[model samples]
Target: MQALIDQIEASLASRLYFLSIFTSLSLPDIAGALSSDNGEASSKKFIAWYEDWVRPRFRENVVSQSPPHIGQYIKELANPFDGESCYRFRCSLLHQGSTQHPKSKFDRIIFIEPGATTNVIHYGQINGALCIDLPGFCSEVLQGARAWLAAHEVHENVQRNLSRFAQRHSGGLAPYIVGVPVIG
Candidate 1:
């Protein structure tokens, strides 16, 4: 869990440094913009780049496609959905500097409040759109990523930590002994 958290934190830092404000990409997530030969004209924007790359990567990266929708499986990558709607949201953000999706589905998927102090706040309304703190949305995505990491790799991480502990310190907690064996 700690490992996953740390990884997520690092990923966030990378996200900020590489993107967050100005996009490094000239063109994003569209056809015929990639060379596959070198790193020239590479993208550093998360939303746009993620929109372009996530689907194919989801198909090729994961072992199984049980739920089929990557968002259903990995909510951290794109919240509220891992489908076209979220992609549209990304498009809106990239092109419009806001997560306002013109379509009702996209609007319902994620409600973004442009200016807010707190990280997150759920605004209730009788006949208007629900307002959500944008910062909170980012935090929620991080939380989802952490959850994803834990769900997928907790056991493997534990095993790796145990092995490392055993190797690092002689007669440590690793290779734990349960009880004495009786002679047969």
Candidate 2:
């Protein structure tokens, strides 16, 4: 998991925004599956995992800012990318190769590339759409995943599931090949 996180970080640092986004979107699924009893990916697990970990990283004020459409009676906005919305986005991007989701609160999601200077656009809603800083989003997800991993590193279930997680072996896996690097 750490290796995968490192790879995502490297991809972001290298300015491979699309690749970083593609891989970053999938981390929640992996973490969610690992935290489950059966180690199978499901919407429930994904949402719960995301809510527990990644959601907290975003600032409360930003996440709570109400949209214009809400009546004055409404006090706060629904998080633009609550677990369900994020899952919708993940499906759209990974399965459909698009950012548009019919069920999503936003018409679409946009990721802003990092600026050359210190100024950066990190997160917000714009005209019924969500805009996130590409690097910042990926980094936050990685941080959340890292924290979850540290907290659960010794858990029997996570350890068991992690055994099945895809990873690269510095040396070839035993009983098949040895002495050469392999990814499986």
Candidate 3:
């Protein structure tokens, strides 16, 4: 079991590595303009270029076909505490940003699990509607959200570190996203 877990972790690491690489390469070319001496002018030019050249391509290639909607699913399971019914739902999203940055410093995968409720103890809420069991469930959900946000922060740090390394190695000519993870 330990070996299996280790293998799964290794596989996930490898996938993340490749995904980072692919994402780096797929990032728009506007990053190059950010390093120019006349950054303001270059930034404008890059934004124009990206709007004209890259945005349409990205919309075509990357955006999903699914309609924007919220959903939930429950799984029936035997409760460990007392042979009772249990349910779990996994949530995720392919999020994007809508800022004015030359290169869209945005794109991420977010994962979440719906708060669980039991017969005796109710979970606080499901999708904003109120429920009145398991008072601690809300706290657990908050913790999960904090953990996800922290993971994002750590990922951003890694990208920033890699950007610095690349800049140093390339004598300041390197683009931020080239060969670096896109964490935003």
Top candidate when judged by TM-score against the true structure: 2
Q: Whole-model lDDT for model 3 versus the true structure?
A: 0.28
In order, the Cα lDDT scores of the candidates are 0.39, 0.83, 0.28
lDDT by residue for model 2 (55-155), tens: 76665434445454643455443445788988899999999999998998888999877876576655588888898778767877887899999999789
At residue 143, give the lDDT of candidate 1.
Answer: 44
Q: Name the runs in model 3 displaced over 4 angstroms.
A: 1-13, 17-42, 62-184
- TM of each candidate vs. truth: 0.32, 0.85, 0.20
Off by over 4 Å in 1: 1-85, 96-98, 106-120, 123-130, 153-184
Ranking of all candidate structures by their lDDT, best first: 2, 1, 3
Question: Which lDDT tens digits does candidate 1 get at residues 44-151?
Answer: 333444444433343332325445674356543323334354455556666877646777353433344434343444332224343434333344444444443345
Better structure of 1 and 2 per TM-score: 2
Colliding residue pairs in candidate 3: 122-133, 122-134
Candidate 1: residue 11 Cα off by (Å): 11
Name the candidate that leads on lDDT: 2
